[model samples]
Target: MTFDDPAVADELILPNFNYLGYLAQGSNVAENRINGAFARLLTPTLAFTIDSSWVHQNWPTGRTSGFDKTNIGLKYEAFRDSRHEALVSVALAWGVGHSGADAPDTIQPGIFFGRGFGDLPDSVSWLRPFAITGSVIDEVPIGSGGMALAPNATTGRFDTVLSPAVETLHWGFSMQYSSLYLTKRFDGGPPKDEPLNQFVPLVEFRFDSPRGQNTAATANPGFAYVAVTWQVAAEAIIPLNRAGGTGPGFRAQLLLFLDDLMPALFGKPLLSDRPAHSQIAW
Candidate 1:
């Protein structure tokens, strides 16, 4: 559920719960997925997160569905400065290995960064709405149990199974234009309505490549409506190559800011029962 964006969750002081629905057409049947993410702030520069997904697979002759293993992670804002509208962060996560699920006790370490043009001169204030974010991660399997059935040399038959996993790379980047930031920080006149002022046109790229394996990627272009307590985003998924997918797809999501919806309760950092009296600037 994490989009590999540096400024994710930086706009508010609250925790978030997001639900996403996905759809894609395959060679024979349609594939669908349901994903969710729960993120909580631990401090001004730290956060905790949990993510999971369920998939519905379809084929010409058969169909199946199952839930993927849950992934738990933590993120630390390594550097930040609102004056420049920039931030840097690092994260680590473990995919809980489970039978009938996914992965093999996998670990992912990633770096993220985001920057905006808000600090530009007034003559180019319009460009201030533009921003960019990116992230890259290393995927590793803990144990050597990722095996596939292979032919046994001694027996001269397919009777052995050998580990098949290798180090993989997961990466993504995004370009966005935040209407909210443009008007709220740079404009002289009042802004538009609540959700309208929060529009952000975004394009995201996600890719993966395993050692000695083919590379695959997906590009998503869409707009998001961000609000104080919630957000909704929709994107059109396009394949970058043959390995990416067959054709265009789509994904829609709804996110709820628990902190804003119930600031007196869930909005505060997890380390403290109540919101901090003094804000920490980074």
Candidate 2:
């Protein structure tokens, strides 16, 4: 499950060594898959990501399937402000074409932004715990092209080449209510017995609009429990329309902070030996 942090534009997540994996079975696609991803910081403001998946699928024609191509991306923090808990970033992702990597090759460029509501007034302090994060991406095909048209029904003769594939735009929006904000920035302290104080409840919406194709969208509601070294989350995936899916799906994640586990390695650049100045804070 995913909840975009309101301060997501801040890219503060870069400091953590995070790994999340999920298993999914789809009603509309007739497939079962396992997907996993990891993100690591390469520098103070740069990060790299690796994502892979295994899929078992059955097409309408009774065809079987296997693993998908691996995916990788690099992101850079373009702007940040610790005082505001805000950040802006840009990233480029690619589907690596290799054996067992059976998905179409593509390149996606994405931009992200997020901000918290810690600057609100006392009258509306309740809403001050809320924050929002958003992203926009453009999907561009790289190598899946030069396709032939269907053969004539009667003569079975090959036709002309198929038209070039169209591009698509994807967007995501997430709203989060941070318990950390409630206790730290709010006027009153939290109830000592409050079990959910560290849990951030959030909802996310994702949309895909393809040129010359039906659009797809999904809404996900979930909660994330933030901790000193890790976090866990689960959400219900609700399709927005038939194009999105026939029914709901599900998502879950276990994210780890590498710096917490291996401070010397994950806390600094792997390519460097110099001592860095990053440290944890309460």
Candidate 3:
């Protein structure tokens, strides 16, 4: 029982009266998510974006799950250099997904590259505040029980991600590592495979109000900056009897932001709604 013994695996923006949504419940399962996006700015570097998402999951043995995804995108900054204070950007994305037992029909394509470091100073600078990104995805698989679970499997997959970010005005940080490689084809012989890895970390804080009339157009306004975020992940599933080893799984997440919630929704600020939390192991 190795693959780390137990393992499991598993966005934002708005406008034009836009919307973003989240709901979560734990101790078995419950999840809901919604997202919408629209952007067009064909110059000043070029841009276009359209996005959509809906996800729902519920389990208590009585099983219930759902999935939906849609995306269209283009973004470009090509290159920028303000006397060696550099910046560059590129993006392309396409996605499609619809449920069957939580996703089977699929098509995805993505590419991204970014770098920016505007001179260094502000306190022990590491390339100003650091930035690096890389992404790739090509996945296509349709139905028939997902083609009978790896039957001549080569449904396509290749992934990579590395991110580093930091900021100061209060506090902000980011860290990420991802790897995916799945390629194997066997209908009569020779082709066996396994490789999947992921890790992520993040920290955040900010509160600024020097008058507050444009603190991002206030809707849940009246903030001077407050943020708390935590995440943990691990996965390893490579077992084809190579010493009978490797099978592991773990996940953790937590988030909190507070300024007001009607004094914890009416108990004089002792509120508990468990904001955006997640965990899984198998």
> Which one is best on lDDT?
1
Q: Show where candidate 3 strays beyond 4 Å.
A: 1-29, 32-56, 59-61, 82-115, 121-282
CA lDDT of every candidate: 0.67, 0.61, 0.29
lDDT of 3 by residue, 1-282 (tens): 000100000112321121112111112333444444543334434456665645454433332333345656565555555444334445554554332223344444333333334345556443333433333333343442221111111433222222112111111112221121112332221223422221222221112111222111111111011121212222222222212122311222221211222224321212233231111100
Clashing pairs in 1: 259-267
For TM-score, candidate 1 versus 3, the one ahead is 1
Error of 1 at 239 (Å): 0.4
lDDT measured at residue 114 in model 1 versus the true structure, 0 to 100: 81
Alpha-carbon lDDT of model 2? 0.61
What's the residue-level lDDT of 84 in candidate 2? 61
Candidate 2 lDDT, 1-282, residue by residue in tens: 332221211122322221212112233235555666666666666667766666654433343445666768887778776456576778888967553543357788888888877767889888777888888889887765434233344654435555465578888898888776645444433346555546788888988888887777878898888665667777777877766776766767666667666676576654444433332111
Best by TM-score: 1
Identify the runs in model 1 with alpha carbons over 4 angstroms from their true place: 8-29, 99-102, 146-163, 181-195, 273-282
- Which pairs of residues clash in candidate 2, taking residues 3 or more apart in a chain or in different chains? 6-132, 9-87, 9-88, 9-114, 10-87, 17-258, 69-101
Model 1 residue 249 distance off true place after TM-score fit, in angstroms: 0.8
Candidate 1 Cα deviation (angstroms), residue 143: 2.0
TM-scores for every candidate against the unseen true structure: 0.79, 0.75, 0.24
Residue 68 lDDT (model 3) = 49
